[model samples]
Target chain A: GAGVSQSPRYKVAKRGQDVALRCDPISGHVSLFWYQQALGQGPEFLTYFQNEAQLDKSGLPSDRFFAERPEGSVSTLKIQRTQQEDSAVYLCASSLRTRVEQFFGPGTRLTVL
Target chain B: GESVGLHLPTLSVQEGDNSIINCAYSNSASDYFIWYKQESGKGPQFIIDIRSNMDKRQGQRVTVLLNKTVKHLSLQIAATQPGDSAVYFCAEKSPGGGATNKLIFGTGTLLAVQP
Candidate 1:
């Protein structure tokens, strides 16, 4: 009955450094999503995965942002050469099916100094 | 180019009073809408959802009303509690974002319940 969970609840990195954030979706979930939330703003879509296949990555801002869900359960979002603009809360969510209600993780707050 | 937005950025209500949060969406193609509550230092929590076909849905102390003609949605909470204080967001699921069911979220409304 555990919900989705993300690792490195808080991450601090110097500008130009690379960082990787991890997510563990709920067991048996087939659909996974990643979102980025800026301060005082709503969460924005980043990418999506249906099982191990990356169905969509349009939400990613640039090539520096990469995500992979190799096993259909664990996912990783990596950002290369961190920028101050990338400082935000990275959220991960999962659902039983597309369009269904999603369970969200606590999120990994990444700060680029 | 379509987006979701809240009519108000902040809402304050006394405890035990009814509260209403309003949202306006520009994507008419959107077929599903959801409400989420997020507290500080946490991720969004699903509250209730309403399909496009229906105008109204109720869950616990929360009720969601959808107005397709005006492209608007509203969440009504009965007897608001202090615990309900958080950022409330309205999200719409529409095609053509990243996948078949991409959700576009609205600017959240900070709900403050006074005890």
Candidate 2:
């Protein structure tokens, strides 16, 4: 079975630009999560979605960060007015409705200059 | 301020030898703990997980031990291989129920397997 998949394995953007990262969770996964990882550090939770409903967005660092998971399958993390501080790997994970173990994607590395 | 942290930044071990990584968590209310393996340029891969109700759990070549009394966690790998060389992290679920809770991750421990 295919695990979670994220597009644009690598991205380079100028400061103040807008970037969108996409994630395709497993076929029937009901839970999806996004995380940001800085260099030499572990991933930090960004947001979570259960099906098509956004359950948690408290981890989002700033108002420029936004996410949505419509249709209960695909999810997107969009960062408006990108900043150098936002240069990090964005990871996506999904899990079964009954399990706490999450399956992660390869992640999209965004470098803001 | 709840957090999970690793005892060592890096660990070097010989191939075929057993390796153990340690973690310390601040939240005593944490009910679930998980071990993840991440390779360069890749996201975290789940290795194993243990709930607070149990003290230990094992997977194919990995074992996770949890100690609620000391708020400690450990991951033991049997017969380490070169492929096991990667960053290992310990994550804990926030104190609550439901599978949708966010995870608090440790800084990570780099496992270097020397053949």
TM-score of chain A of each: 0.97, 0.99
The models' CA-based lDDT, in order, is: 0.93, 0.94
Q: Per-residue lDDT of A1-113 in model 2, one digit per residue for the tens?
A: 88899998999999999999999999999999999999999999999999999988888999999999989999999999999999999999999877888899999999999
Worst 10 residues of 2 chain B by lDDT: B93-102
For model 1 chain B, the run of ten residues with the poorest summed lDDT: B94-103
Considering every candidate listed, which one attains the maximal DockQ? Answer: 2
Clashing pairs in 1: none
Cα lDDT of model 2 by residue, B25-93, tens digit: 998899999999999989999999999999999999999999999999999999999999999999998
TM-score of 2: 0.97
Q: True contacts preserved, each candidate?
A: 0.65, 0.81
Colliding residue pairs in candidate 2: none
Give all TM-scores, in the order shown: 0.98, 0.97
